[model samples]
Target: MAGPTTQEPVKTQQKCVAIFALLCCFAVLVVLIFSSVDIWGDNEDGITEENCSKNCRIVLVENIPDGLYLSMDGRRHLPLSVGFHELLDQAKHSVEVVSPVWDLNSWDVETMPSTAKQGQLLFQRLLSLKSHGVKLKIASSLNNSAELKTLAANSAEVHFVNMTALTKGGLHSSFWVVDRKHIYIGSADMDWRSLSKRKELGVMAYNCSCLALDLHRVFSFYWQLHERDYIPSIWSKRVTALYGKHAALELQLNATQATAYVSTSPDLFCPKDRTRDVDAIYQVIQSARTFIFISVTDYLPLVNRSFRGTTVTRYWSPIDEMIREAVVLKGVKVRLLISFWKKTHPLTFNFVTSLKSLCMQLHNCSLEVRFFSHREQKDDIQYGLNHNKYMVTDNTFYIGNHDWVGSEFAVNAGVGLVVRMTNSVKDKGMTILEHLKAVFERDWRSRYAKNL
Candidate 1:
C-alpha cells in the first residue's frame, strides 16, 4: 500500500511539471509569431515620429484669378500650377494623390481652351511620373472620368472610393504625398477650374516626413476601401493616424517652431487615434485669444440626411454656438468672409444675419460678416470665384477641404491641417498665420466684399 501511494504522488508531480513546460512553449511561440509579423506598420526605412528630423520648410501656394486681384501686400506667392509642378519634379520614388474629381482634361470642348492648358500639362506630368520608374497611386470617388481611365492604362494605380455608398455623401479630400517626405494640402482639386480660374489656397511642406506619414495613412485608408461597400470592422495599423490633436508633431516650420496635426471627417472613417474634423475646429475656436478670421465657400448650420428612404434634417449648431460664445462670452473678435457665387445657399444670408445680431446691443462684442462676390467678364459659371477654405486666428492657422456645413462634417470625407506657431517667432519671411491673416484682411476690405 505504501509503495502504491508513493508512486501515485510522484506521478502527479510529473503531470504538473509537464503542464508548466507546455505553457512556456506556448508563450515563446506567441512572442515569435508577433515578432515576425508587422502588426505595428513600422516605416520602411525604420523612421518614427520621435527620431525623424523636424526641420520642415513650408510655403503658401495660391492661385489668383487671371483678372481679379486683391491689393493687400506686394508679396508674390507661389502659384498653384508652379507648386504642383515643383512637387512632381521633386518626386523620386512614389507619388500618392487623393482628390474628389479627376476632370483635368476638358473632354467636352472641341478646341482646348487656354484656361485648361495648365491642367492638361499637370495631367501629362503625372502620367510621366510612372515612366520615370516612380510609382503613382490615386484615390478618388469618380467612376467615369476619362482622365482617370487614361492614367490607369498608363501604369497608374487608380482606386475608387464609393463615397455615396459608404457615407451617403462624396469624398472632398485633396492632397498629395510624395516619397513619404513631402506633402501638399489645400482647397484645389484635379480640375481645370482649380488649376487656372478658381481662387485656391493651400500649403506645401518639404522634408516633413513626420507630418507626411500621418497624411499618408489617410490615403492608405481610402486606398484599402476601393471596392468595399461597408466600413471594415477591424482596421490594419497601417491606416491608423500616427499623430492627432492630443499628440501633435512638434517641428520647425520655416525656422519657426510649431506644432501641427491632421484631422479627418466622418467618424466611421476615422481609425485608431485620428481626430475628427469637427473636434479640430472646436479646438481652434476655443483656443483663440483675440481674433478669428474665417473664409469658406459656404456656412450653414444644418444637416440633411436620408434615412430609411426618408429625408431628415437637423440643426447642427456646434460651430455656430462656438462662434457666438467666442464673441459674446469670451469677448473675442470674429470676422467671416463667405463666398457669394451662383450656387450660394439661400439660407446662408439668414445665418449671417443671426450671427451679426449677436453683437447688436452688447458691449465688447465684435462680429462682422462679408460676402465676397466675384463676377467675370465672360460669365463663366465655374471660374473667377474665391474657393478658399481656411481659418486664421491670432496664433493658429487651419487649412481644410470642407466648407462650414454640418452635412460636410457628418458624412463627407475630408482632411484638415492645424498649425500653431508662437507669436514671438519673427523670421524674415512671414509665417503661415501672418500670411493668411494678411490675405483675409485684404479680401475683407476689398470692394468685392459686401456687408450683411
Candidate 2:
C-alpha cells in the first residue's frame, strides 16, 4: 500500500471535529427545548389550546367476573380489555405504559386457565405494536420480569426504576398514555388477574391531549430515572405537570363541562405544579357535599419504615384525619368498602371501628364501613381480591393505583386522576361521577358486602 499523505490525516481530523460540533449543537437544542418555559404548552396566562381541548369523550371501564353480576342497569360500561385494545389500535406514533407488574402471559404454561386468555390476547396486541411502526416504551420496577425482557428484545424500549433503592418503595402505578392524546389510569395492573379474575376499574379518555400530555410527563420522569439510584435535585421542566389541582384542564366530557387533572404519589416524585396523591384524595373528600364513597383493597393508616437500621411504626394520619373531618365536621356521609382477603391487616379493623365510633352519638355524622368479600373456586388469595382503589363523591370522581395504606402514599410510586364535572347533573348522558357512584352502590348493596 502507498503511504498516506499528511493532508489526508488532517482531513479526517477536521471531519471528526465537525461531527463533534454537530452533536454538541443537537444536545444544546434538546436541552433548550425541554428547559424553556415558553416551550411545550403555551404560557399565555396558563390557559391555551396546547394543554386544553374541547369535546373530549371519557368512558368508564371495568372488569367484572361473569358470576359477579350486579343489578341490571341500562348503562353498561366498556370492558377493561376492550378499552386497552382500543387504545392499542388508536396509537399512531407512540404508546407509553407504566405498570408495576408485567405477567400478562400468566407464566406461559401450556395448561393455562381460561381466565388467562384475555391477558394473553392483550400481550400479543402489545407485541404487535412494533410491527405497525408504533413506538412502545414501558417503565416498571420489576427486576425479574421475563415478559419485559422479551419485549425489550423485540424492538420495545424498557426502563427500570429502582424504587426500592430510592424511597424503599415499589412502583405500583398502572397507566397508559397513547400518542400523547389518549390515556388510561386505573387500579388494574398489566397482569392476568387484573384482566379476568380480579375486579378492576379505570377511565379511558379519548381526544384529551391535554390530560394525556400531563400523564406523559409523568412517564418521562420515570423514563429519566432508568439507571439512576437517587433522584436528581433539580428536574427538567418537561417532566413537570402542565395541569394540576388548582389549574385543571377544562374540557367537555360526554357533552358536559368538566375539569380534570392527574396526581402522583409520594410527594418526592411530584415535581413542580404536580399534586400529591393524598392531597387529591383529600380534595375529593372535602368537596363532597352529600356523600363520599371510598373503595380500596387496603385501608391502614400506619407507616412502617426502617430508620437507621431499626423498624419503626407510626400512625400516618393525613387521610384518616381527612375522612374523620369530612364525616364529623363537614357533615358528609362517608361510606368505606374495604376488601376482605387473606392479606387483610389486623389494624384495618381497629381503624374501621374507630371511624365508626365518630358517628355513634352524633345525629349529623354518617360513617359506615363495609367489607367486600368474594368467593373463588380455587383457594388463591392473590387472584380473586377486589383490586379497586377509587373514591366517588356527589360531584367528583377519583381513580388511583395505590391502596388506602399509609405506606403506599408515603413511599410507593402511584398515580391518581380527579375529574370534577360542573354540569354533571344536567347532562343528558350519565356522567363518569354518576357511573362510578352507581357502581359503588351496586357493590355496597350486593350480598358480598358485610357491615362492620
Candidate 3:
C-alpha cells in the first residue's frame, strides 16, 4: 500500500514468467521421450540406413516370360543356348531343385536324362551329388504326395517336416537357394501348372550379398530341422564323408550371415500356432502414419472373447482393427482394395460378407474399403481375377503371396518381403497408391454404372 499500485504489477509479471518457464520444460520433456522411443519412426532394429542399400534395385516383373531355361522341370532344351543352360552346366558338384511337383515328360527335365527324371529328378540329382561326394539337401512340404514319395525313395539324406505343424494357420513358402550364392523366389510352383499354365512372377538374383545370405539362412534352418532325428542313407553318408563334417558345418554357418525369418502354414509337416505374427501385424498397422494400402483376395472378420464375460462384436474386423485405430485415433488415411471372387469357397464367401458388415460399421471412420472385380481393359465384359496381396504404407512396402484375411491364419501358406525405403530414394508409395485408386474406380464403375 505504501508503494502504491506499482508493486501489484511487478508481482503479476513474475507469475506470468513462471508459467511460461513450466510450459517450455514440459515441451522439452515430450520431445525427448518421443525421440528416444522413435515415436516418429520405427526403431533402428526394424529398419536402418545400412539395410536399405540404394545399389539394390527393385525389379518388378509381371506375367512369366518365355525363352528362359526351366530349372525345376526335367525337360531341358537340347539346343540350350540360354543363360539357364550355362548355369546348369557350370554346376561344379551338386544341383538341387525344389518344386511343388516335377513331371519327367516335361521338356525341362527330359532334356537332361538321369535315373531320376520328373519328380524323381530332384532325388536323383541329390544322389548324383552324393556319389561325387557333394553334400545335397532338399526340403519340401510332406503334403505333396508325389514329391514326398520321391523324397522317401531317395538315397540322399531327406528331412520331412509336417507343414501343417509348422504353420498352424498358414502356407509353406517355396524357394531355392543355390550354393549360398544365388536365389530364386517367386509364385511358380514345381508342378506342371506353375511351369506351363499359371501366370507367375519371380526373380533370380546373383552376387547380392544380403539377399543370398538371407536365402542361405532360410535353407539352413529347414535343413537343420530336417536332419534333427533322421539319418541319411549310405549314399548320403558317403557324400558326407567326402565333404567332411567341418566343411559342411562351416558352409552352413557361413550361410547364416544375414538374418531371415521363416513362415509356414498348417500342414502335416509343420504344426505350430502363429498368433504372434498376427499380433505383430496388428501392431504395425496401429503404428502407421500417413496412409495404409492393402490389396487382398479375401477379407475375413476376427472374433474373440471380450472382457465382459460375453461375446462382443467390434465394428472393425480383427484384421482391420489396427487400421481403424490408425485412421480414427491417429489421423492416418487407410485404403483397402479387396477382390470379390465370383466363385469363392462357401466359407470364404461368408467371411467376405462379414467384412462388408464391418466396413459398413466403420463408414464414418477415415477408412476407404472397396471391392474390385476385374473388368477387361479393352473388351469391358471379359474379365480376369485380381489376386495380389500387398500393402504399402508411407515408405514401407509389404509384398507377399498370401491374402490378408483372418483365414490366412489357418489355411493358406504365404510369404512376403517388407522393405523400408530411404528418404532420398524415389518413393514408390504414391505410385502404388495411384494405381490402386484407378483400379478401384474402374471396378466401382463396373459394379454400379450409374451410381459410381
lDDT of 3 by residue, 126-216 (tens): 4455555554556655545654465456554455544445443323455555544455554444543343322244444343434444444
Best by lDDT: 1
lDDT digits (tens) for residues 65-101 of candidate 1: 7777679478678999999999998899889999987
RMSD of each: 4.7, 8.5, 19.4
For model 1, the local distance difference test gives: 0.87
Give the per-residue lDDT digits (tens) of candidate 2, residues 1-452.
34567678888999999999999999988877666543433222242345555668888999886667667477778999999999998998889999988888866544655756898899898899998999899998987889999889889999889998889999999999888789999989898878887888999999887787788889988988897899876677677788888998888888888998999988889988999998898888889999999999999999999999998999999999999999989899999999998889999999999999999879988899999888765655255567899999998999999999999989999999999988744456577788899999988998888997
Given candidate 1, what's the lDDT at residue 16? 96
Error of 2 at 208 (Å): 0.5
TM-score on alpha carbons, each prediction: 0.90, 0.88, 0.51
Candidate 3 regions exceeding 4 Å error are 1-57, 64-136, 147-158, 164-171, 199-205, 227-280, 283-288, 302-318, 342-386, 410-414, 427-452
Question: In model 1, where do residues sit more than 4 Å from their true spots?
Answer: 1-45, 108-115, 376-381
